[model samples]
Target: MAKNMTLLWCTGSCPCWRAMIALEEKNLQGYNHQLLSFDKMEHKSQQVLDINPRGQFPTFKHGDNVVNESYAICFYLESQFKSQGNKLIPDGPEEQALMYQRMFEGLTFYDKLGNVIYYDWYVPEGERHDSALKRNKDALVAELGLWEGYLSKQGSGSFLAGKTFSLADVVVFPTVAFLFRFGLSAGRYPKLEEYYALLKDRPSIKASRPPHWLEGPEEELLLKEI
Candidate 1:
């Protein structure tokens, strides 16, 4: 099965990282993989467009099956290879419910973060308003606070869904890492900081650490104030 899989991804894309981590946690080895350059706009190249019309970072294929969306790819892998690797979905009903909740909630979290991070890129400087940017950042800070509360309720050494790592962790960890990578003040969210620290060394995360991240210094602090 591994031999039949192929993945095309770009470095430092959290969605791409999610797919990479899922494959690693599934212990799916020997799969064909390619690293494209976002700086060169290779993610929008013909090769990626052939499989994914959107020309997304992650164009994954399992035999004839193509799963482009990162979260969908993770879910598909877990469902098809349930017995092959670490069980991502918890066995208990309540745990599974929480995993699903957090996993979907992660989408909102990502959207909020993206609004702030990409504000300048998306909005023209002349049209960009400080008020709008502050609103976006404030929303992100509140989102982070909500996550911190969730983690606090779980106590120390607890995964997003429960004691054991689940699909929730797989889905959300990259966004959290992204926050820290852009200098989301660790002191303000100790629980999130711990979560980031704990998961950074996880085998899957270490193995799939963003290639470019290892080669360069961290980028300018985007969320330093928050």
Candidate 2:
């Protein structure tokens, strides 16, 4: 089943990691995959452009069907191979609702984090303002608080959305890991810290971890204050 699929991805990209983790969770092995270098602008190469017009990392193809969006790729894989491996979608209604909520909320969470982390990269130096950067950082801190509260409410549940690891974790874990990788302090958000530690050793996460992350030191302490 895996032989028909191909993935073009970049290391350390949360979206790219999302697709990789999903594939591993589904136990879909032997898929053709290439690691592109973002530093070299390989994501813009003709190969990715052929599969994804936007030239994004995680240009995924299953047979002739292409799924470029990371979350959509996960959903599609689960729907297409429901019986093949671990069930990502929960069966209970409450858990399903929570899973869907967190899955979409993960987008907003990532956006807030990116706004702060990539502020200087995305904004021209002359156009950048300290106030704007502070606002973005404040937003990310609040967003982390919300997630911490959600996890606290989970009580004994180790996984997001429910007691079992579901699509919510698959979608959100990469972003959370990215934030920590960028040096979000572990002390301020203990629940998130614990969650990260817990998921770090999970088979899928371990197997699909960004290779570059293993080779170098963590990025700047961008969120150390918060």
Candidate 3:
């Protein structure tokens, strides 16, 4: 619709980045993007909470529709703007089902890894749990290899969805980022290493990488190598 519509951003979070990746891919740039500071708890400000009751980041205000959850937000942007640019969610039941399946798998299969990483490492050392972190790391190792094996046998290049970048790519990038943030590297994980090179170098990825990716101890200690 109008260029005046604002896309509020927060701390370069993965969920937020999904909408951004789609927007940049389709050349839907230059919408008023306001950056919020997670460090300052700006996302919880009344203005943000009004837009999203859950008070989460990645909340989008597109005309009258208020959207939350990364997957839903990305889906809305893709469908509403489908006529405009490169199609992200392609037509056909097989592709649609595969997209939905992979997206769901990301939440169910991968979110556990993300949560453990967050509690273990992202929570700061004094408050972190060493036991939970180790257990989570072990589980993630097993699961990540599962993805590597799947991709190897699937007859594809980098992505889970074959050639083109799709919802799968959007779903996967942040988890990989999160994994790496705690000193986990794709090199140790094999398939992720290959996928990391492929996904991180995308034009949109280049455009929207979160600032913290380069600034903090997590950036230096975890994400830099990935």
Candidate 4:
């Protein structure tokens, strides 16, 4: 039985955005959405902490069952609602395995990018380490190049896993969007640019894009080389 779904999340959180996109793909009826704010420390409120001990923004609940962590929530939704809405995982074991592999690879890219965001961009200017920042940024560029190469190698396909959009796209699209949010040039990586352009206007993507992003200033967190 598909119980009612509820998601507790903050705006502009990449992980939260991932869950939102997944839910959008699922297109479940009678779901609950509570949009909290990190600025107000709403995630740490007693109610949120009770459901998620870590006070994370992307906590989800299906009836009485609580699940934290973004990807887990996405996987759970895809598995439980296999027959509903869009088919994210796709059919066949080989295809499912490939999708899982690419999804984790997307996380690797997210981690590499986070190294720069956490150490270089988020850290205060006085405490920031120039050498470490450059190292992390260089690593991030390398990660971007990796995806660029992967897309190029995949040939004429518009998606990471192939012709159709799948969970791999759900997991990776936000990371690429985040990179663009930080001002990475869409033009530099033509394949990636094409991919982003396609996904950007997707109904799910547009509906789930961070609300604050529509009203906030653009973050220029990367080097001009992007």
For each candidate, give its TM-score against the true structure.
0.97, 0.97, 0.84, 0.91
Error of 2 at 64 (Å): 0.2
Candidate 3 segments exceeding 4 Å error:
1-4, 120-131, 216-226
Task: Please give, for residues 113-224, the per-residue lDDT of candidate 3 as tens digits.
Answer: 6656455445766877768766766676677777777667655464666566787777767776666666766556766666776778788877888877778746335323
Give the per-residue lDDT of model 1 (tens digit) for 1-226.
Answer: 4999999999989899999999999999779999999889998999999999998889999999999999999999999999988999999999989999999999999999999888998899799999999999999989999999999999999999998988899989999998988888888989999999989999998999898887865767888898
Deviating ranges (above 4 Å) for candidate 4: 1-3, 120-127, 219-223
Deviation of model 4 at 98, angstroms: 2.4
RMSD of each: 1.1, 1.0, 3.2, 2.2
Better of 3 and 4 by lDDT: 4
TM-score of 4: 0.91
Q: Would you list the clashing residue pairs of candidate 1?
A: none
Candidate-wise lDDT, in order: 0.92, 0.91, 0.71, 0.83
Give model 2's TM-score versus the native structure.
0.97
For model 1, the superposed segments whose C-alpha errors exceed 4 Å read: none
TM-score of 3: 0.84
- Identify the leading candidate in terms of lDDT: 1
